[model samples]
Structures are given as C-alpha cells and as structure tokens.
Target: MTDSSNRRRLRVGGLPQVLLQWGFGGLAALVLFLMMLLTFVDVIGRYLLNAPVTGSFEIIELMVAALVFCALPLVTAREEHVTVDLFSHLLSARTEQTRAVVVGLLNAIILTAMAV
Candidate 1:
C-alpha cells in the first residue's frame, strides 16, 4: 500500500473509536481545567479573603488521579509512550510491529490483573 493509504488506515475511525478518543480527551481537559480553576480560587480565597477553599487539597489530589486515568487511553491510542528502540536498525518492520503488539498485550494483561 502507498504511504497515504497506510496513513489513512492507521487513522482512528468509526463512531466508537471517535467517541472513545474524544471522551478521553474531554475528560482529561475537564479535570485539568477544574484543577486550575480550583487552585486559582483557593489561592485567591487564602491570600485575598483570608479564607481558603475547604477540601481543595483533597480535591486536587483526586483530580490528579482522574487526569492520569483519563489520559491513559488517549496516550495508548496515540502510541505516545516512551520506548528504547535499541534494535530499530536490526528489526524488520513486521517484526517490530509484532513485538510491539505482544508487548502491549502483556502490559494490558498486567494492568488488568492489577486493576482486578
């Protein structure tokens, strides 16, 4: 296949995929925005009004967790994880792809086990 065709094929499609991608993106963005807004309000309340936003620290901690979880799927879908491709020059394209898939599956299984 041509490069364009390969690129097109690799692009995410379908309602479910699109929805999942957007859902994750939206969730992460919302969490981050809320965190920033909360921090601003907390700081203003503390410094200007002599009253801090109650539970802001706990809320921020929860938001951080939520942000990480929300971004996980998007990161995985984009294959944005760090890698050490020491054998990039030695491995064929197919071999590299197979290796990636196998590694991803193993990681998924481990994560699922941990979640369970």
Candidate 2:
C-alpha cells in the first residue's frame, strides 16, 4: 500500500468521549453513593442517637431526581432505552431514518404540550 492510501483520517473518538462517558458514570455513582451514605446516616441517627438527619428525606428525593434527569441524555445518546421494534427491521434504512425523525418531532410536540 502507498503511504498516501495508508494514511487514515484522524478520528475524534479518544480521550474526550471516554472522559465524557466516564464523567457521566462517575456522576451517577457519586449520586448513588451519597444517597446510600445519607440514608445510612439518617438511620443510625434515628435508631441509635434518637435524632434523624435533618432534611434527609428531602435531600435524598432531590438527589434521586437530579440523578435521573442527568442520566436521561446519556441514556438517549447510548440508545439503551427500551424501544418497540415492531416493523423496524422491515423498514429500509432511509425509511427508518425518516420514521425516527418524525417520531422525534412528535415527541417534541408532546413534550411541549406537557410543558405548557
């Protein structure tokens, strides 16, 4: 092979993507860890010390919500969400892309309605 043909274009899938994915995972793990630790502390304080961690319930609820919200984009980007695949395999590639775009538009409309 000639050197010109052997030269591959530089790809942008190295440390950046790895760091982004890992950062998201780390955030999720940190939230989970904090939740568990807070719960444990709350339990210990209530049962052993006769005093609960103040606002522990609210804090955990907020943390859980934040974790889920933060994970949504990552999940969508990864295509790890459950999807109805009925007729998807039968569709041509172009048709599938069109369907996906239309579905996305519909989702946006529904979301906008709900928001309003």
Candidate 3:
C-alpha cells in the first residue's frame, strides 16, 4: 500500500480522537517514568541503605498493568499492534486486504465485548 493509505488507516479525526491519543500517551509516559523511578530507588535502597522498597514487586506489577492499559488506546489508534506477517509474501494484494479487514473486525468485536 501507499504511504498515505497506510497513514490513513491510523488516522483518527475530531476532538475525542485528539483527547484519546494525548490522554493515553501522557498516562503511559507518566507510568513509565514512575516505574523507572521506583526501580532506581528500590535498587539503591537494597544495596546502599540495606532497606529495599517495601512491596516493590507488587507495585511494579500494578504499574505495568496500568501502563499497558493506558498505552493500548494509543497503540490501537496507530494500528501498531504486533503481528506475525508470515503470510505476506504468499498472499495476493486483494487477499491481504481482505484478511486485514476481517482481522480488524474481529479485533473490534473482541474489544467491544471486553468493554461491556
């Protein structure tokens, strides 16, 4: 596909789209920063002060979950999710497009179910 077409696939319009992108992006960045800070403090406390941060593992686990959830909307908006792409060479252009549409619909249905 052309570059513009590829971009159009990820393009969202209107104010809500802008809000969703920025909100999720900001949340993910904040969570990542906090995760890094926590890890640094935990390491320093363990080695230098002989007092590791309490419940660091649980905190990290929850932060990671938050991070993923916060980032998922942006990732979906960008259509950047992981895929195998192993059959790209074998499929014709039309078949590939059809496959992509089918997969996209399936993803929408699954996500809608999860939301409900």
Candidate 4:
C-alpha cells in the first residue's frame, strides 16, 4: 500500500489519543473526587460547625447522575463494560469475533430502541 493510503487508515496519532483520553478521564476523576470531598465537608460541617452545606444532597444527586451519564459514552467508546464469559474462552478466534459482532449489533439495536 502507498504511504498515503496507510495514512488514510490511521487515526489521530499517539499523542492526540493520549491527550484526549487523559483529558476526559481526568474530568471524570475530578468529578468523583469533588463529589466525595463535598460530601465529607458537608458531614463535618453539620456535625462540628452546626451548619450544614446548603443543598448538599441535591448537589450530590446531580453530580452522581452527571458522572454516570458522562462516563457512559466514554466507557462505551473505550469498550470498558463488564463481560461474563463462561463460554467465550473455549471459542476459536473467528467464533469469538463473530460473537462480538452479534453482541455489538444487539447493543446497537437496544440503544436505538431506548432512544425512541
């Protein structure tokens, strides 16, 4: 294949992928850390200072939802979901590939249905 054709098949280079991955991953991590920190502060404030952080529960609830939903698309893109593979280990490579494709198709259909 020509160099140009090879280049066409290639995606963003290593540096870009690293940057993008870390950028999103860091955002997710920061949200989680902030959530924990706020909860801790609120607890301490209520018990020790006799003044709770106002709307702490509401903030936590919203943060939790945002964290999960925001992470969902990234996790799907990263292919990071759990799998139960009682039979998969026994399958040949081609069989495994076919199984994966089928699973992906089903997931796509389910996502589409959910969207509707």
lDDT of 1 by residue, 1-116 (tens): 36675346346465677678788899899999999999999999999999999999999999998998888767676667788878787999999889988989987887677567
TM-score of each: 0.77, 0.67, 0.78, 0.67
Superposed model 3: Cα runs more than 4 Å off: 1-12, 109-116
lDDT of 4 by residue, 1-116 (tens): 35674344335345675566567678778889989999999999999999999999999998887776556655665555798889988999999999989978887787667556
lDDT of candidate 2 at residue 74, scale 0 to 100: 60
Task: Please tell me which model should have the higher TM-score, number 2 or number 3.
Answer: 3
Sequence-dependent TM-score of model 1: 0.77
Give, for candidate 1, the lowest lDDT window spanning 10 residues: 5-14
Model 2, runs deviating above 4 Å: 1-12, 87-92, 104-116
lDDT of 1: 0.83
The C-alpha lDDT values of all candidates are: 0.83, 0.75, 0.85, 0.76
| Best first by lDDT, ranked | 3, 1, 4, 2
Query: What is the Cα-based TM-score of model 2?
Result: 0.67
Checking candidate 3 for backbone clashes, the offending pairs are none
